[model samples]
Target chain A: MIGGRPDMVDDEHRLKMLMVAGLGGDEAAYRAVLGALARHLRGFFRRRLASRPADCEDLVQETLLAVHTRRHTFDRSQPLTPWVFAIARYKLVDWLRRHARQDALHDPVDEWRNDLAVEGGQEADTARHDVSELLGTLPAKQREPIRLVKLEGLSVVEAAERTGLSVSAVKVGIHRGLKKLAAQFRP
Target chain B: MRTDDLVALLARGAGTEPMAVPARVWAMAVAGGAVAAVALMALMLGVQADLAGKVSTLAWWGKAGFTLAVALPALALITRMARPGSHVGRLPVALAAPVAALWLAAAIQLAGAPPGERLALVLGKTWASCPVWVTVLSLPLLIAALAALRALAPTRLALSGAGAGLFAGAVGALVYTLHCPELDPAFVAVWYVLGIAIPTGLGAAVGPWILRW
Candidate 1:
């Protein structure tokens, strides 16, 4: 399958051919792999984080670089897509971690606060509707703990005290409740 | 850098070392470290005075055998982890079985022994320094493992580091056996495993930093 696919048309096969060639020291094939990978990563990150365009492009570039450096490690037995995307996933996580730390320390100036309020009304309404819909699906045991915890702003111990259950039992109920809610939310 | 520029850059290969197979790189790294550890041990901590006599007993072979057993899964884990997107699926089970088996053996030994003896068996003579020594010995191996990791890509840095550390710990224990006289399976099972765990913990702590591209 290496270098014979002059018109494979499939990304997976094309990528495999390019990787095989690149590892064999074909600069042209290696360049082709990067170009294709860059395009693939753009789509991948864009779908995952549509709100962050700059982050998406930056991540695409980082992932391509990583793939380039780590090309020798790509196992011939495995598919090309997973290896590429795995690097992308790591880059995304690192990016998220870096952004989280920066946000934690960089004081919020609130210059765009009013602008957010003006634009967020529709999104907030949808979010509120979705939350209630999701919360309504749970049983009383699970729902009550969630209400006490998330909705009522009570601590786990307080919620347990109010619910007449042991602390461990309350925690279990909360976990089970969230798990059920998550199942329902899955597409 | 722009994708075009990046491709052109890598294509140029300007002084970049030609990439080798991941397995070969890792094997060389770990193997080199093991040899270095052995050499260092020979120079700084010579073999115990009565290794030959102890070999006739269950202690010497028992320690060496057990250390090799623990090292097996760690080697398998690194083989898979040395590549990007390679799943570490159920590889942990491989690492856990030896520990769990040893622990079970220890518990059984403890159950049969007298209450006074059970305490002594669990805490061997060198409980305080065992972990520290193992950690120190693992540093060289860890560095080599980290060096090997640089050429390949690991998605889970911490997990990969832990694997490398565990491999080194097993190597450390293998070396420690040459000096120490403790023979009880219970002691080897617990303390030697603890020695290994120290490096694994450090690897987990530092992997994110060391393995970053």
Candidate 2:
């Protein structure tokens, strides 16, 4: 019953069985599961960081490494997505935080602007830095939704799909975040 | 890393160390903890003064039964969560409902009782020490349970730790029943629940660090 994708529920069941089988030491199943997860992580990272497609592969690798290293922590009796994505999301946030600071300190004006993409890398960097600062002023509940909807230009339904919140909940988060941002900025 | 290279790398090292089935690990850990708690209580605290007369009452059974009831689901969740990416659906509500029902029942029973007596009902005699003893008694079980979980993968370390702590708290409360003569449902609802919560909190606090691979 989640947004835009009917396959989400099936993926949950498949991932659970795959993980359980993998934990039982089935090598083939384990590979299949990780491969499937790698694909999912690629899409997951790509959607949130559309402006930074080049980094998605690295994020996927990092998340996969986390999954592999922390494999023992998965619960065999629970749905797999929340657990897997929890790590992916954690990695994504960490990546953002680390990158956010470097981008803020460096001036992008000196960098070459690529002509092919709709927005140049430097423009994206400036836009992202400004967005990150704006978002940083809000709490995570509000900040995440604002980034997904207003900054990344995802539809409310799309943002809900990414964040696992309901459409209404995402809307509410954006509303509340903007309210707080507005209050903070007003004279 | 491309998917193929990652897959090849992951599969090369893809094997779990052989370990006991999850059920067995759960049983041994829970049983070991329960035994230790009971033994510690007997060695140090002995039975409550009027236990002989009170042993046959429903209140005594309620005390034991309440703890066992809460412990079972927590044990199942902890055991299941020991494996990576597994879920124990609906088990959390299973743990919470009984606690809620007892509190509601206690409120109804004490509704018409004198106001001062109501205070007596909630505090009982061991209010001060009950929570502390529950945590103390829970230590062995919590240790053993965490040890059991260590062999398996647990991504949600804090949650797994809380489950272990809850399991220990329940069993500790079960053992404490031997020494605690508090018969009022209100007393059990308040103090005994608090006792269970102590380890659950401690587990959450330390879970991310201790259960980390």
Candidate maximizing lDDT: 2
* lDDT (tens digit, per residue) of candidate 1 on A66-111: 6654666777777888788888888888778877886687657653
Candidate 1's DockQ: 0.16
Query: Residue B121 of model 1: what lDDT?
Result: 89
* Model 1 vs. true fold: TM: 0.73
Instruction: List model 2 lDDT by residue over B60-177, tens digit each.
Output: 8877888999998998888777765466799989998889878887898699788879888788887899888878888899999888877555667889999989998998888888
Candidate 2 chain A worst ten-residue window by lDDT: A122-131
User: B-chain TM-score, every candidate?
Assistant: 0.88, 0.88
Docking class of 1: incorrect
Provide all candidates' interface root-mean-square deviations. Answer: 17.1, 14.4
Deviation of model 2 at B55, angstroms: 3.0
Window of ten residues with lowest summed lDDT in model 1 chain B = B9-18
lDDT of 1 by residue, B1-213 (tens): 244554554444212224457767877988898888777777777778998888788656867877888788887887778787788788778778778877787888889999988878878787777667767777788789878876567778999888888888898888878777788878878788889998888887888888776
